[model samples]
Target: MKSLLFHRLALSKDKKGVLELSEQGQEIQKADDILKDPYVLEFLNIPESYQFLESELEEKLISNLQHFLLELGKGFTFEKRQYRISISGKHFFVDLVFYHRILKCFVLIDLKGGEVTHQDVGQMNLYLNYFKKEVNTEGDNEPIGIVLGAAKDHVLVEYATESISNQLFISKYQLYLPDKKQLENELNKLLDDEHDNSASR
Candidate 1:
């Protein structure tokens, strides 16, 4: 009876082994199929939307700007916003100032509600120049400036940066998240066209 029981257990294990392996293989195949789909790939790659100052009150926006900077990625640490600086006996406030550890200097950011203008970039450059001259340490690199706005004109931005010696960057801010399906569809169309061209070649 003991030998018969042992034999039965062995047979049961042998019978289910192939079935379990087959199920695992099927799961792997499904995962691979999902990964190979262009829509899925594009959805995974889309960046998260950034929050803008205009969307919230000034006090709240100042408080939350640190999180916003992290979402911007790269090396950034929130130093102060609406930071006060005095030049030639007049006082000025800088919006969204940060210190970049990697860049080893202060980063001054200006927020714009409407279209970015040359004046906006100029103000940022002025802040950078002042900070570099007054606040920067001897070992610190030159301060950099960034102007983020609702809408930016590329030509205007290019013109603004032409004569500036300081490191400057301009980026557009989005209040709402991107549409996943729309982004996916665009990526899929581009991928399909590329595949077709490669096949023809």
Candidate 2:
């Protein structure tokens, strides 16, 4: 939650690169205000070696809905799994759907078993467009689409999302907790750098 707040509050970049709370952040108006990157799904308790299909993963999440909801942050209420949407005569399914009371928008999530691809992002964009055009009510805001993959190439995702207008984001999910020692070392290094700066001053 702390990490989410840090990034959430800094939605827009000024000319000088200074960070401040965005208009949306102040009102919790956008999905980015509440979404977290690299969502830690340590509670899923799936073995690292286990190779599970996307459907299997969805089942696990449904089974652990309470913990999953907590990890998803506040104001998320589960609406459905495999929520079907029809486009023309064809059909598509979103892995998970939720409603954010604060944002007043539908949250669409697509789970990927491995690295996220451009196609995955494109598909999510389609879902968002569908929801915005077909699903949103008079008072509802635009829907948010999240592509949650096991791995993502930062540069790839960055480029893929360029020029898109809808509220779309791609995030990674990990089954295990992060390395504590690595975190401690990074924190220590930051503290040491601060001390050095103070001494020089």
- lDDT of model number 1: 0.60
Q: Report the lDDT tens digits of candidate 2 across residue range 1-201.
A: 433433322222331222343322333555776666668787889999999999999999999999999878778999999989999999999999999988888999999999999999999999999999898999999999999999999899999999899989988888875466755665566568669979999
Supply every candidate's count of residue pairs whose N, Cα or C atoms clash at under 3 angstroms.
0, 0
Each model's lDDT comes to 0.60, 0.81
Segments in model 1 whose C-alpha atoms lie over 4 Å from true places:
1-58, 192-201
User: lDDT tens string, model 1, 55-125?
Assistant: 34235455555445534444668788689989889998887777776657777867676678998888888
Worst window of 10 by summed lDDT in candidate 2: 9-18
TM-score of each: 0.64, 0.81
**RMSD to the hidden true structure, all candidates:** 18.0, 5.0
- How far residue 86's Cα lies from its native spot in candidate 2, in Å, is 1.4
